[model samples]
Target: MKEKIKIGMIGLGGRGMGLLRLVILNMSDVEVVALCDRYEDRQTKAADKVEEKQGSRPFVTIDYQEVLSIDEIDAVIISTSWADHIDIAIASMEAGKYVATEVGGAYSVQECWRLVEAYERTKIPCMILENCCYGRDELMVLNMVKQGLFGEIVHCAGGYQHDLRDEIAYGYENRHYRLDNYINRNCENYPTHEIGPIARILDINRGNRMVSLVSMASKAKGMKEYIKNEKSHDSELAKLDFMQGDIVTTIIKCAHGETITITLDTTLPRYYSRGFTVRGTKGMYTEENQSVYIDGSHDHYQSWNKNWGNAEEFREKYEHPIWSKFLEEGVQGGHGGADWLVLADFFESVKKGTQTPLDVYDMASWMCISTLSEDSIAMGGHPIAIPDFTNGKWITRQ
Candidate 1:
C-alpha cells in the first residue's frame, strides 16, 4: 500500500482553494506536490497556504500540463471551470493519474464521451467530487431506500434552488466563469449537485439508467432585474442580454420505469435547498421538511403536519452505515462534512487501486444532463435520447 498520496492541485479558484484549506490540507496522508491555475496570484496564494501548512511550497505553474508531467504525483483534484473540466480530466487520466474532478455539468455529449474514452484507454480511475452524494440526509434516505423503507421508488425530484443573483451579476469582478455561461447559454447548466444523489438512489448506470429527458426553461429575467436594482453591480451588465433562464425543469425517464425531475433554479430568489425528494409505493422522504413518512407507520392523512422533521426520529435505525461511522469519528469539513467524506472515498480508492464509487460512467451520464437539456430546450422541449456511455455494460455492472 502507498504510504502517502501525492496530489497535484489544479484550478486555484474559490472552490479549489476552499477544498485545499478545508479538506486536502487536513488529510495527514495526502501531500500536495503541485499547484496550477491560469492566474498567477491564485497560484501564489495557494502555494503560500500549502507552504504554511506543510512547511514546503508546491511546484506552481500556469499550465496544468506541467502539473500532470510531475512523476511523483499519484492523482489530481480538478476544480476548474465547467468548460475545462473534461479536457483536464482526460489529460490527467492519460497521464496515469487518478482523477477527482469537482462537480459541473458538461458542455457537450461528445466531450462527455471523450471522458469515458480516456478512462477506458488509460484504465485510470476518475471520480467526480459530488459532495452531495455523501450528504448525511441523502445517505440516510439512500439507506432507507436500500433497506426497503421506501419500497419501489417510482419518482425522485431534486433541484439546485439557491439564489445566485449576486454571484452571476458580479462574476466579471470576481473573475468567475458563471457570468459568461449565464450570458450565452440557457439550460439546466448545473444539475449534478441534485442529480448525483438521486441517480445513486435510482441505481443509474448500475441496474438502471437515464434513457431520455425533456427540459423547459423559464424566461431570463432574474439577472437583468438584479443588475438593474443593485446599483453596486457593473452598469454594463444591465444592458447585456442574458440567455440563461431563471428556472430550468428537466424530466428524465429511466430504463427501470422510474422518472426523475431535476430543476436548475439558481438565479431566482430562494433559500438554499437541493429540494431532494423520494417517492415510493411504501413511503416517501422530503428534504424541504426534513421528514420521512412511511406507510402503516404514521397517520397518512391528518398527522403529516405533526410529522414535519420526523426523519430525525428514524435516524438511529435508518442512518447509512457511512454516516453512522462518520458520526462516531466526528464530522469535519465543509457542506456538513460531506466534503471530507467524498475526498476520503476518492483517496481510499486511489490507495487501493480500485474503481471509484462514482466512476467515469456516472460522471459522463450526469454531466451530459446539462448539454442534453440545452438541446431539448432549444427544440421546444422535445425529449432527447440520453447516450449510454457505458456501452451496454450497465446491464450487469454490479
Candidate 2:
C-alpha cells in the first residue's frame, strides 16, 4: 500500500462538498485525483479546492466512468443521491477500488444483498460513511458500554430531529433529492444518522443482529402546512400531498433480547439534534440534556443530591481516544470534527489494507432498516424481520 492514497469523489452536493473540503484540508494521506458530478459548477468548484490545496488541478468529468477508469484512483467516495449510492458502490468495488458511501438507508432488500455479494466477491472494502459513529460523545458512550460501565445494555434511542421545511420546499431549485423522497416515501427515509451510533454501541452484526422491527408514521402535515403558511398560500406544494409522515418511530428487536428505538423527526419544526440516548441495567445517558446517570455511583447519587451529575467531569474522564487525539491536534470540519476523524480513518485503513470500522455487513444492517421500516409501516406497524445480510457468517465475524 502506498503512503498516499489517490481517491475520486462523486456528487458535489452539500454533504459531498463538505466532505470534499474536509479531505482537502485535513486528510494529509489522501489526494482526491478525480472529481465527478452531473453539475459542471459543482465539479469545477471541488477541483478548485483540490488545486488550491495541492497546487495541481485533478481530472474533472461529468461522467463517473471517467473516474472509475483512472488507474491512479485507489478508492471512490460515492456521495451521490440516495438512489445511486448502492449502484455506485457496487461499480466501484467491481472496478477494483475501495468504496466509501454517504449516509442513506437502502431502498430495497435486494440492493442491500447486492452490496453484500459484491463486497464478498471482490474482497474490497465498502464502507457506509456514517459520521455519527465517530461523534465525540457517541464514542465516549460506546467506550463506557465496552468497559462495562453501562452493565448489560437493555435499550437505546436515537433520532434525526431537525427542521428542514425550507430546504425541502425549495429543493427543486437546488436539485436536492429529499423533496421527492419526502413527497413519495411513507417510512423511515433517513435512519443512518441515528442508528449508526446505536449500532456501534450494541456491536451489531458482530455477535448480535437486529432480528425484527416495527414502525409507525404520523400524517404528513408539516410540509403542506409550511408551504401554505410560510410560503405563498397559492404555492404548488401547498396543494401537493406528501406521503411521508412528520414523525416516524421505529422499534427494533435485537437477537440478544435488547431493544432499540429510532425516530425520523425531520420535516417538522424542531431544533437540530440526533437525540442519542443509551440505556442499560446500570445506567443511562441522554444527549439532549447532556446528562448521565449510573446506579449506586457517585454521579447517580449526586444527581439525586444536587439535581444533576457533573457531565463535564464525566466527559473529561471518559472521552474516546480518537477525540482526545483530535482535541490535542486541533479539531476542525463537519459535525464538530467527527467528519475529519472518519475520513482520516478511511484513508489510513485503505493505505494499510485493513478493514474499515464500518464494514459491508454493518452497512447492510444499518441501511436495510429503511426498507424494512417501510414494510412494517405499510402493514400498519406489523413487525418485519430484518434480513441477515451475512447469512450466518455473523456468528464468527467478531
Candidate 3:
C-alpha cells in the first residue's frame, strides 16, 4: 500500500478515456502503468493524455495480454465492451490483481458464480465501478431513505432512458463498424448505473438480496439506421445492426419483501432520463422534480434545497470535509466529477486494505441481470433465481 497502486487501462474508447483522464488527473495514490486499445490512434492519443497530465507516460501497447501480464501493474480497469467483461475480470482476478470493472458483471449465471468464487478464493478486491451511486441526487435519495424519510420503501422504479441513436451511429466511424449495435442491443443491459444507488438505498445484498427478476422486451429500433442509413450513411457503420428499439422491463423482488421495478430502454429516441419514482408505506420520492413527500409533517420537501438537489448546486452546499476535499482541488472529468471520486475511493480503500465503494457482493446484486435478464427473456418473462453472495454462509461466515 505504500507504493502508489500501479494501474493499467484496457480500453481507450470514450468511457475508457474518461476514466483514464480522471485517474491520471485526480489520483496521487495510483500511477497508471499501461494503456491498451485496438486502434492505433486511440492508443497514442491516450498515452499522450497521460503524459500531458502527469509529465510521464505509461507503457503503451495494442495487445491486451501485454497489459494483463505487465509486472508493474497492481490493478486493471476494464472499460471495454459488454461481452468481454467476464473474461477480462476473470483473467485479472486470477492473475492476483484487483479488478474494478465498468458494468455488467458476468453475462451468465455460471460466470457470476465464477467471479464470486474467483474473488473469494484469491481474497482480492473486485468491484463494479457504477458511478451513479456517486451522483448527488442519488446520494440525497440514499440519505433520505437511511434517515427513514421514506419509511419502508415499498416499490421503486429505475432505468436508463438515454437516447444514443445519434452518438451510436457516428461515433467511431472510421475505426470500428459494429460497435454501436453491440452496445445498443440489450435492455437495462447495463443496469448498474440505474440500479446501483437504488440498491445502496435499499441495502440490497446488505439487508435484502434481489430474490427474483422477470423481464420483457420491445422490438428493435434503428439507431444504426438513423446514422448508417440516414445522414451518416456514407459513414463506416453503413450496415450496423443499430439495435431494435427495446424496452425490457424487469421486476425484482428483494428478500425482505420490498420490490424494485427496473426497466432498460434505449434506441427509442427520448430525452435523457434516469431517476426513480419511489413509493414507500409512509412517504414517497419523485425524481420528476426532486421532491420528497413525508409521513407526518412539513410541506413537500424539495431536495433542491441546495442547487435544487441538482448535482451542480449540491456541491456548493455539500459541506462534508472528506467529500469536500475531493470536490475542491480535484479536476472534474466524467459524470459531473463523480468518476474522479470513484478512482480516489478505490485507491484510498486499497491503501487501507478495506473494501472499495461497492464490494463484490454489492456488485453481484446490482449486476445480476448479466445472467438473469436473458433467462427471463428466454422463459417468456418468468421469474429467475438470483445467487446468494453470502453463499448461505451468513450464519457461518459471520
Candidate 4:
C-alpha cells in the first residue's frame, strides 16, 4: 500500500465537486492527484478547490482519458453523468486503477456486462459508490435482517421519490445531464439509491439474484406541467416534451423466491424520501413512518400508529457496527454521513487491495434495472429477464 492513497477525480459536476469538497479532501490519508471534466471551467474550479485544501493544484484535464493515464493514481472516483459512468469505469479498470463510480442506472445490459468483463479481465476492483448502502437506517435494518429479526425476508420495497422537476427543467441552464435523459428515455432512471441497501439485505448477486422484472410507467406530465407553470412562455424548455414518465414502478422477482419493488418517482412534486421498506415473516421496517414492527412485539391490528418512530428505540442494540464507530468518530460529510462512509470504504479497499463491499457484479445487476425497466415498459409492462451478471456464481456465493 502506498503511504498515502492517490486519487484521480473525474466529472467535476455538482456531485463530483460536492464529493470532493465534503469527503475526499477531508480524509487525511488520501491525496487528490488529478481532476477531469468536459468543461474547462469545472476542471479549473475543482483544481482551485484542491489547491486551497491541499496547498497544491491537482493536474486538471478536459478529457477523462488523461486522468486514467496517470500511472501513480491508485484509484479514480467517477462522478460523471449517468451515460458516462460505465464507459469511464471500464476505462479506469483497464488502466489498472481501482474504480468507484457514482450511483446511476445503466443504459444497456450489454454495457453492464462489458463493465463486469473489464473488471474480470483486469482483476482491478470496481465499486459503485452507492452511499445509500451505508445509510444509518439502512445499515440498522440490514443488521436486524442478518440477526434473524426480519426472518425469512419475503418482500422489500423502496423508491427514488424526489421532486426533481426544477432540476430537470433547468438542466440546460444548469449544465445538468438529467434533462436530456428525460427528453429521450423513459424508465426507472435511478434505482440504486433504494435498491443498493435492499440488495445487501437480500444478498443479491451473492446468495440470490434478480431473475426478472415487470415495469409500468405513468404518463409524462410532471416536467411539462412544471415548465408551463413555472417557466417563461418563451423559454426553450417549454418547446420540449419529456419522454420520461412521472412515475415508474418495477416489480422484481429474485431467484430465492423473494420479491422486490422499486419505484422511480422523480419529475414530480414531492418531498425527498427513499421509501425504504422491508417485510418478512417475523417483522417489518418502514422508512416512511420511521418505525419497526415485530409481529409479536407490537400490536399488529391496533395501535399501528403508536409504533411509529419506534425504530429509534432499537438503535443502541441493533445499529450496525460500522455506524457505531462512525458515531464515535463523529459523523461527517453529506447525505447523513453516508457519503463519507462509502468513500472511506472504497479508499480503504484500494489501499489494501481488498474486494470492495459493492463489487462489479453488484454494480452491473443493480444498474441494469433501468435498461431492463425500459424494455419492460416498452413491452407494456411485460416481464424481462434480468441478466445474471454473476454467471450462476450467485447460487453459492456468500
- TM-score of candidate 3 relative to the true fold: 0.85
Candidate 3 lDDT by residue in tens digits, 1-398:
55577888887787788787655455667778898888889999998988887789889988778888987787888888766776778788888777888876346667777778888888888878887777656766666666676688888888887776555555565443234544554544767877787787777766467778887777655554465456664544565453333677888888778888877666666777786777887877677566666566434554445433333433344333444565567646578766876766777766677777687777666666755876777677888888787776433321
Residue 239 in candidate 3, Cα distance off native in Å: 7.8
Worst 10 residues of 2 by lDDT: 300-309
lDDT agreement of model 3 with the native: 0.70
Q: List TM-score per model, in order.
A: 0.99, 0.96, 0.85, 0.98
Residue-level lDDT tens digits of model 1 in 1-398 = 67689999999999999999999999998999999999989999999999999999899999999999999999999999999999999999999999999998899999999999999999999999999999999999999999999899999999999999988887987899999999999999989998899989999999889999999999998888888888435657778989999999999999999999999998877899999999999999999999988889888768577879989999899889999999999999998999999999999988888899999999999999999999999999999999999999999998
Find the candidate with the highest lDDT and give its number.
Answer: 1
**How do the residues 325-380 of candidate 2 rate in per-residue lDDT, one tens digit apiece?**
88998998788887887887887789998888899898888998999999998999
Candidate 4 wrong stretches, greater than 4 Å: none
Could you arrange the candidates by lDDT from highest to lowest? 1, 4, 2, 3
- Which structure is stronger by lDDT: 1 or 4? 1
Relative to the unseen true structure, what is the C-alpha lDDT of residue 89 in candidate 1, on a scale of 0 to 100? 98
**Residue 347's lDDT in candidate 2:** 79
- Give the 10-residue window scoring lowest on summed lDDT in candidate 3: 307-316
Q: Considering only N, C-alpha and C atoms within 3 Å, which residue pairs clash in candidate 4?
A: none
Alpha-carbon lDDT, every model: 0.93, 0.87, 0.70, 0.92
lDDT score at residue 77, model 2, on the 0-100 scale: 91
